[model samples]
Target: MSQTRFRARTRIVFSLLALSVMAAPAAAQTIVSTYTPLDLENCRHTAGKAEEDSGVWRCAGFGGIPVHVTANDMRMYVSYGGNAKNEPAARETLASFHGEGTSIEWRSERAANGKLKPFATILRFRTSVADGDKTVPGQVLVVTRLAPGPVCRVGYVDGRANPDANALARKIADERARNFRCGTDKAVVEGATGPGFSPPAE
Candidate 1:
């Protein structure tokens, strides 16, 4: 190859490399962080406080939200429920909480762990209590395994200074449900919903 041509090609390569380097920070920023059982435990008010009951793992306060995880037969079954249409069943699986708020809608219905099984839904909304009271104005995240119905609902009972944790709860549920590979003897969905769940689509 001609020296001039080689030099031109080298310049193009250098430009591409520079672009990639420049783009690195943006890509890193977009990267979501995942959580583990330990991390969830750490979210408690006192930290390292978690309890297991009937195959469900309950955390006092995950990112300021009362969180619970269940990987039972029901959960594993629903996690793999067919397509978006199964979302209704997934919704039903959740035991009703205090009261429904005005904003109720779908958050996401997708494969857990980026696979075809273990589908889950991460829902966001507020409670029906009056807005002025101290106990009012909290958010609820109902993450249900639509395929098999392992619902991990989180409630942010009190307000917090850092609102980012409110969003992180959903991501935690997403990763937990995606990794929901439960079995008879062993039922547990494991993974961190790195960073936080994406804001609901406008």
Candidate 2:
């Protein structure tokens, strides 16, 4: 009964996930990208010698598109397995990300409420296609709410920035929530292709 109830509520929440992607600025970005869903259920990516977790997910490596994107995963194994002991430790370890540009960038921003929640810790890595430029531009933000497993809920903003920087950030955040697919459906950005390319997912 509890499992059923959990499934029901989760379904309701994610129903908004797909719609959010479409309800964005009329003149905003046109995603010209293609992707394949990475199934983390295989367990091969999660296994290791120690309790620590490590894995990687490649989205565009299959040559479906010129844009290649990959994410390398990381987790810390607690020598002591208790919440209280780890809360402070997590806080200390998840410090402010003080870098920017190239592949990855970290920033400090005041979130909702006067208090801060470490804003965003962006990590990005990708292998570009032969037709693609190595200096491709993209941005990402992820919140890995570690339950029994690392069930990560990620948000990202792609493409280059325009003159208005603040507008760019807000547009990215809006697109992030819109592009979010909470359950099994992998979130996709349609029309992210180069030249006359268009994603079938769109």
Candidate number achieving the greatest TM-score relative to the actual structure? 1
lDDT of 2 by residue, 84-174 (tens): 1233113211111111123222222333443322222233212122225533323322221222222222332233222333234333433
Model 2 regions lying over 4 Å from their true place:
1-113, 118-126, 132-181, 190-192, 195-202
Report model 2's TM-score to 2 decimal places.
0.27
lDDT of 1 by residue, 1-202 (tens): 9999999999999999999999998655432323323232333232222342124333432122233333332221111222322333222332212322222222344243542222343434333333344333334444444334433232221212235643554555455555554332222222322222121111
Q: Which residue pairs clash in candidate 2?
A: 20-178, 21-178, 31-191, 31-192, 32-191, 32-192, 32-193, 33-192
**CA displacement after TM-score superposition, residue 46 of candidate 1 (Å):** 43
| TM, every model | 0.36, 0.27
Q: How accurate is candidate 1 locally (lDDT)?
A: 0.35
Enumerate clash totals for all models, in the order shown: 19, 8
